[model samples]
Target: MSEFRLDERLERDSDFLTKIGLCELRLMKDGRWPWLVLVPQRPDVSEVFDLTPLDQTMLTFETVLVTEALKTVTGATKINTGALGNIVRQLHVHVVARSEGDANWPGPVWGHGTAEPRSTEDTKALAARILDALKP
Candidate 1:
């Protein structure tokens, strides 16, 4: 089997945070929201069903883990998760924290506005908080 590699677009648009059982967790660079991306480590897979049964189970568990961690860290009113691979064909899941009056409140976060890139210091700080929340 080919070794796993992150898609170039994902690599460019996000910062690596940490890894879980079956995925590499990344923080999206857009500072508009507390967004996280979970990419399964399996190479060349582009859909959830493409993953093995074991991996599918692990993905579900990890997705929930990430969603809760995001909510804990951000205290968001609601959390959103999606796996629309229309643009990035990689099998990645998004776990986003949302509030009542965020920049694009009640609307989708994608394609609504320009991304405000997070500074390195800010990114590291957020990632550390998220990692801390993910601990058992």
Candidate 2:
């Protein structure tokens, strides 16, 4: 067994929000969209199928939980969920809130434009809102 560690690239691109069951829920720093990354706290796992059966179920449950919270907080028209590890080879799921007429409407958020990082105050406020929404 190995100790779990978040990939450096992910750590650089996102801010840690809170732990959600089997994963650490992080907020992407990009202000373009309300995005979250759920990284399973399991070492050496690069894909969802690599997780144990129980962990796989837990991951699915947490993903939905966070996604719902995001929708509630952002009032997004649609939610985009994905696990494309083409760049970062870590087992992480992305849950993004999308709305019509956004900067890149009817298209993917990735590679559309350079990411505009959120300010410190804005980030803190948004994180607080998300935390409040995640409460049971």
Candidate 3:
């Protein structure tokens, strides 16, 4: 299959997502749940299994690294990771930290509410903390 690339739609939406660490971390557009999205630098891969075995392994490691980082920084009650391309088909994983009082608590975070959008400064601070907590 061809390499994965963000489509025009995703690319356009990414502008706002980028201001926050979400873009740097290849995270998704959701603003709640202290979530993250990790996409391998390689571009037409759609699913994790589509990656070469080595890349697949690296993605798994990245997922764990991100999970640990979020847990430490956000003190999330649970770390939820998955890859659902119903929207963006790039081979990327979502790492969302769940808490009882979170915005989307007790339900999926996809469309329950409008994204409040993190502030540039706050996002940077959060990103820095996440980076500092990262092991790899």
Candidate 4:
């Protein structure tokens, strides 16, 4: 196995917030809605079941747990989850909370508009809140 989680490696390699959770819980980027990326930190794997049986099971369990937790946190009208890796082939699943009139209403969030970057303090506080919620 790799020394570090693939998601950890990606987070370290990027400037994004190193929020919380390793596999199960979501590390959301603080925003109007709860948008999460569930990434199993296994290396060189494309498919979900590419993981060992144990890891695959863990991933499934984690996905469900995060989905429910996100619902509780966001209270969204709908929850959308998908794995689209056209840009990053790192096997990450996205969980987005949906409402009736979101910015990308009736459309995909990607390529719809420029991302609204959160303020530093706001981002930090949001991350802290999510971390606290995900904590055991």
Give lDDT per model, in order.
0.93, 0.93, 0.67, 0.64
- Candidate 4 segments exceeding 4 Å error: 1-32
Which pairs clash in model 4?
A: none
lDDT of prediction 2: 0.93
Q: Measured by TM-score, how close is model 1 to the native structure?
A: 0.96
Q: Quick one: how many clashes does candidate 3 have?
A: 6
TM-score of 2: 0.97
Writing each residue's lDDT as its tens digit, candidate 3 over 19-115 gives 1222235444446657677767666677777678887777776677778988999988888777778877766667788998888676776657676
TM accuracy, model 4: 0.74
Please write out the lDDT profile of model 2 over residues 22-111, one tens digit for every residue: 999999989999999999999999988999999999999999889889999999999999999999999899999999999799899877
Cα shift from native, residue 2, model 4 (Å): 5.7
Relative to the unseen true structure, what is the C-alpha lDDT of residue 56 in candidate 1, on a scale of 0 to 100?
Answer: 97
- Pairs with steric clashes in candidate 2: none
Give candidate 3 misplaced runs (Cα > 4 Å).
1-24, 27-31
> In candidate 1, what residue range of length 10 has the lowest lDDT sum?
110-119
The root-mean-square deviation over C-alpha atoms between each candidate and the true structure, in angstroms, is 0.9, 0.8, 4.1, 3.6
Question: Where is model 3 poorest over a 10-residue stretch in terms of lDDT?
Answer: 15-24
For model 4, residues 10-120, the per-residue Cα lDDT tens digits are 454223433334453344443555677777766776777677888778777777766676677667788888877776777877777788798776676655555566666
lDDT of 1 by residue, 28-52 (tens): 9999999999999998899899999
TM-score (all chains, Cα) for each model:
0.96, 0.97, 0.79, 0.74
> How well does model 1 score by local distance difference test?
0.93
Error of 4 at 107 (Å): 2.5
